[model samples]
Target: MHILALVLVVLPLAASQLIGGPTTVDVNRDDVQQMASFALTQLNTLLGSQNTLVSVVQAKTQVVAGIKYFLTLDIKNGKETQTCTVTVWSRVWLNDKQVTQHACTSRTKRDGLVGATTSVNVTRTVLKMATYAVTTLNGLQGVHNSLDQVISAKTQVVSGTNYFLKIRMSDGSQTQICDVTIWDQPWSYMTQMTHHSCVNAKRRDIGMPGGLFNADINSPDVKNMTNFALGELNRLQGAQNSIIEVISAKTQVVAGMNYFLKIRMSDGSQTQICDVTIWDQPWTHMTQMTHHSCVNAKRRDIGMSGGMLNADVNSPDVKNMANFALGEINGVQNAQNSMVQIISAKTQVVAGMNYILTMRLKEGDKTQICYVKIWSQPWLHRKEMTEHSCSQVTKRAGGLLGGVTNLNVNSGDIKEVAKFAVREINGIQGAQNSLVKVVKAGYQVVGGFTYVLTLSLKDGDKTQLCEVNVWSPAWTMARRLTDHHCTAQTKRQLAAVTDADVNDHFIQMLAHYAVQTINTLDGTHRAYVELISAKTQVVDGTNYFFKIRVRQGTTTQLCDVTFWRQVWMNSMGHVTEHKCATVRRRNVGGVEPAHLSAPLQQAVSFAEDALNGKMNSMFRFVVEKVENISQKASSATTYSFDLHLVSSTCRNNGNSYGKGITDCTPNYGMLQRMTCEVTVEYRPSSSRKYSLAADKCGQIQLV
Candidate 1:
């Protein structure tokens, strides 16, 4: 069966390179019919075998030309009536190096057991003895050159560690193959193998272990050997479990399987374990472990490579943890407090000298307090005193005593109190060197008051002043005393009139005059006294000089009266000369004679008539009456002596009294009557008075 299998495998390679080779094919008589058909079948079989081998060789040659590894085989078949010869030629290449002309020959004969009627059987065998003899002879010549080439090709290196091995037939045909070997460490080799194994394993058929090969171990079948080897490596490498261990050389602790250990170098430069076996661990630990050194006894958490666990967690000095926490809390509190204080201060209303100040403390609590102090000046009191007698005295003074009130003190009142408080401060008196008294009176009003004094003295001398005044309700007068006699008298007589006596006399005289004046005039009328020089006189012949002002109720009146009796005697040198004249005038009559002459009478009459509203005009009456009357009077005697005398007096006096006289006159008589009219315009008793007078005279009269 093995020989048949070998024959079946080799028969297809006999067509192309071995043109004159023998070929064989198997047949069953039951499936064949006639002799011609049998022969045609054999021929077709032989030709088909050769053509199939040639096709395979052509395909392999195309592959070798295009790619790095390839194999090609050619078969030549020759057939006789009962015998056939087969020649096989093969070409193989590994990574551009090639060996050609490897050949093998075989012979086949018909053989069979007689079946029902005559059956045919075929027998094939490699011509080893004949091929050896041919090979030995070819070796002596260059016919074995291809064999040497094949031997050289087998020893040639192709890939990194792969070599080629060749097998050649005695007919100058060959088959080429590859032998691959990896020189890497078991771990690296296994790691790569593991990846390929996993890929293949995933594609395996059910119940079949991947890469199982049914080839001889001594001469491995290259077609499936690589796959089988990779699977074995995969099993070996994949068996290693990932473990955690400290790598002192790398200053790291790592977790990974053998594959990771094989691929990565433990240089501190690469701190992270990137292997898939260690992928389940935390990344922080992975990195940290890769960098950890044996200098520390314990492994740090995650990325921290140095410092003890207790030191990192418990020591405040390294982190300032307490201060940081406290700072956060204080910052929030301060902000809140600032806001509260701002609102409080903003809401508070201040007036006058008060101010609102906002401040914040440790916490957020807010308080608003107000302060106020009333402002005012101090009041002063004044006083005065006078002496009436040795034991009788009166005093009077005025004062203003007042103080500030309604002071409101609030939470912020300290500054206001300090600013406005009044101590016993110094003060100045209105009048220095003047007798006065002063006292503090303290804060008499709601707030406080200061007092001072104003004093007046009868003698015009006062005492030293003081700061304030003492208030009192009293009246007193200042007094001075002196003594003198009414007349120039001897020293003894003046001495006899003591101060009291002189004072009494003066008082009595003043009282008597006051009484007489008051008795003679009503209260609305003021009384006055005057002392005048003896030479002073009035038109009424009275002389006295002194001016006195008297006030009755609220009215003040000035009056000057010159007494004639006192003044006349002083002028007459004590002679009673005016007594006889006064007596004669009185004895003759109480009325005086008509002293005015004829023209004066006429003028008076005319003035009287005109004043009686007889004339319609102002001065026309003078011309009409006086001129006409004078013209009619022929002789001086015809005019009345009164008229003549009055005219002469008017001429002597040079009086332009026509309007006055005319306004006052009446109808004319023998001597025209002259009139005198006085009009008094009186004001109210409280007002000033005025008067107007009119007199009449003749218009044209001889004098």
Candidate 2:
């Protein structure tokens, strides 16, 4: 059965109908319709398909950063047997940027389809959908820029009496993002609608109103002065030059009236300065025009240059007015000056140098405040007077010379700072243990009276330098500076080395691997074996550091000889008490030091079997004591060592059980012994080269 349905796909409904959020009612109807039309056109292209019918099912509207519309459409395509649903979204922003998106899926078809449409009803369906979409979009809000115009129109449309919108610009002090729009009305159509504009809610005025006068500058004398002033102003404006002048004119003031200055020129140019004085200033009486000047004047030792106030008059009225003006200026300065404070500081005390002095002055007081930083020697002279407010004083004065008072105020702990640095380098996502320790701390002369207290920190292979600048005088809290100069102890500049025959080079490379293996064991900063010594074989035999003794019946080889890895003090002979670490474990049955000249035990076993008459195997081997390695090329040098082999034909010099001795009788042991010297080139590189040979002699067979 073919069901016929015609549905319109459109933008979202009014914000009020969707949820309790902002409604952009203040937007102009024309602009809103234009935006909606643009969005609908784009939607058509996105949803266009061959032999497909689409209809709007539902629309949702929301208001957050801007207006957003979510539209649900029912889609049917002749190519597909199943129906699908498409969701289209459109977001309109205040900056005239519009974004629209749509997605279609055959997953689940919503139940709100008006009805199915046959081929004959297809044209009707498309027209109905387009019309509905355009209508709905035309009613949607436009870009917020035209908010003011929409609000004004709305106020005039009903009766030209009621004002419905107020526009307010946002300042940092405002807490909420506000958008004002008119309430949706039934009589207003989308094509002819107006909107409201967001505005800062007016703050209630609690202070009692004072008496003030509304001035008229239309009088003959006033008109002449205003005309001249206007001419000067116009000339300045034409030249695009700034004019800095004191405006002083005689004008009569009437109590309890609004003041206005209106200027009119013959050429139809006009100028007006209305509401020159708010309710804060009151005029007592109307009198003949009198001259009042405050040109670079000083009253009560307060400099009033660049400002005009009635400080010349001794009358109570003039004094009150002057006091009020001074109070306001002081209040503004105080707020700005108190924003910063130096709670701690550091400074250098020079024996004979003279430093500039800093001091704070009282409000409205013009006296210079200065205090020279001095020592026992003769004071140096400075001619300039450095001016500083409360905030600038601490920073400009070098430091609080007296000392710090609060050590904890506004200062980060040095150890904590170092730990944070390490964590960042190691990529730790959360807080972890502080791995650095302060080594040395002292004050250093930086510049003038400013000094930075520096600290040195060491943690395993990491080192960090920290500097703290605390206020002097009462050294309590710091201002402006605290930092850590992190230096990884293990970090080294790569060196170019070509020597591959040095024994130290191979040992160094092996040592580095051992260090890495040790670090990976528990993943904590631990001591590394920074240096390795070569094998020392004495006459008593395998007594060297790299050699191991295999007893008569033991299967142990030279590889079993393990070194206890620990960190040693670079300057001292002893190991580090806390940073020292145990040896790293190997893949074998026992743990061993990673730093080694070679797998000596393995080499020895291979050599013994190869030289023995039983095994028809051959292997070249070497053993040697690592000699001195130059400090400059230690990181990149390859090492070489001489391998010494001592083998002999011998039987187990002990008794064995007659029944269990399958391989050899107690006295007759199947063994061959021989001695030879071979050289092994040990490269710190990934590959090692060795030369080994064994020839059979009459009684001794060497392979």
Candidate 3:
């Protein structure tokens, strides 16, 4: 027989409480089988000899954690037709000691022929073989404990197979105490250590002592015998009953609420049974009673449910349900209940007590047995009922169970809700236009069937769970719940909007507009421009003005634009500057508004002369007010501005000695009275200055 390597090494440590050695103890069936096989091989070899036809007939092994165990073998040995029945008992002590004893009786023929009998005393051989097996176990420990030497080990058997071990080792600073089981006991023990180094003594109470002895509950063979009974139940109930998908099996063990399963049998017939029968305790004889602990209950005591989804223990369903429960149970943080096991399964109904379903199927001379653990009442407190009881029985072989199509509310739809929420929160009008990204979706169980799913949404730097909905299996509709639960919290160590992020976005927009403006200004049809740098100033903590430094083949110009939140609340009614809208506030280096006044014309002429190298002077103009005439797009792109210039000034390069002597100054009153109808074209560009898109500069008319 093949055994896992981990089982070989780990199970022996658990043997301490039973066989006595270390604080850690774990037992496996393979170890017991190995011991039995080894003892039988030695005995078979010793018993074989001349003038004797000795052949091994049958061998069996029994191992219990806290009990002395034995391997029994029946052999037939005789000459000619005469035969003798020989019984062999291979026993092992708790301390890794092995011993074997045999009793033989010869059968004489009715013809009066005497059978030749030999007296055999195999004491020395048995003791030698026992010593050898014990020595082999000792050798195994040497390698097993090579990492951590067991300084001292003390064990105390509680009552039955339950026991505790106290051990001190040189590897750790503290002594380790743990509870273990002997011989595959029914009680559940804490397998994990208390600390990283070793389990503490506090975990010892998790194991219970004086566990009730029910061989069918503890023995794999006896438990498997119920599979036929279960198959018979399925055959009887196969036509009328069908399986239902369970939302949750263990924690929510409500009768008529939790759904059971229907599995297709190899015969193409659906096994429609969801309940188990306890043959040891007749169902009719059962009484409606509750027990504090079902593991300690007897036939006269309380039993678990019958048809509850959680209580249905079909062979395949048992493992599937157990695995599902484990995943959900383990997800709980710092769970007091770590493991689950089904100690008893019966058809009888015990009020408010957990039980296992039992079934038996008879095929001519053979019987197929099945068992299922049912969880009811307060399931969390009854951790023992969470485990599976039908390990020995094989799952019914078939393709798959057929059921009505259940429209599972896909989690993928959460993205849509997130998009909707992002649109709502970010004021996006449609899902396609919304840039809301779903970060994660968390699900919460509601009404034991439906789920309230919350989706975390992200828009640029802002994040929130903007969308929540109720989703359930078999329901086609994903009902919108609420958007109030999700609120944006700034990411850790990240401010609302970084200077770099704002700058980058602004630069990108400016680059796009600048290229377009430059192409229109210079008529070069260029697709790109060299961005010098943006000079920014914050105003009223709400608006940001950018002075874009733009250059096109050594022709550098400065342009100005302001970014601010729109005057109205976003479509979602959220007051946020997540997306900046552009406002053409002024001309280059000028405040107020843009106008085609005398000062503006003089400044324009100065700029033209400066570009032509005809004048060595810096030009300045004051824009009194500017109005955008273009329709607003998703982003600030192109805009038409009506300019009103107030004043203009020019400094003569020859007047260095006189400091700032103006070569040409426009009349302020004259510029103020005129509302310049010159259309100042602006697009997002690298240079802050707007190029003459449709230069009708001198066409300014007085308002």
Which prediction has the highest lDDT against the true structure?
3
User: Which lDDT value does model 3 have at 238?
Assistant: 40
Instruction: Please write out the lDDT profile of model 3 over residues 137-233, one tens digit for every residue.
Output: 3353342211111122222112111112222211122223222211112123222222112353232221211111112121122223234333343
lDDT for every model? 0.22, 0.28, 0.31
* Better-scoring candidate (TM-score), 1 or 2: 2
State candidate 3's TM-score. Answer: 0.16
Off by over 4 Å in 2: 1-24, 27-450, 453-481, 488-703
lDDT tens readout by residue for model 1, 386-468: 11111112232432335312222222332222112211111111222321111111212211121121111111332211112
Winner of 2 and 3 under TM-score: 3
Sorted on lDDT, highest at the top, how do the candidates line up?
3, 2, 1
Best by TM-score: 3
Q: Count the backbone clashes (under 3 Å) in each candidate.
A: 91, 57, 50
Candidate 2 local lDDT, 1-703, one digit each (tens)? 1232222222234423544342333223554444444545544343332323344344444554555544434445554422322222344443544433333334224533222321211111122222232233324523211110110111211211112322222122321112332322211222221332333333321111111122222222333344444444343234221212112222211121122222222222322221111111122222111111112212321211211121112222222222333333356455322111112221222332222223333333233222222222324432221222223223344334433222231245544433444444333222232444433322322222222333334455544333234222222132223222222222232121111211333333333333333323323222221232333211111111322111111121111222222111111011111123233322212112123334543433333333332322121111212222211233333322222322222221222111111232222122222333322222245454322333332322211
Q: How close to the true structure is residue 565 of candidate 3, measured as C-alpha lDDT? A: 26
Worst 10 residues of 2 by lDDT: 567-576
> What TM-score, to 2 decimals, does candidate 2 have?
0.16
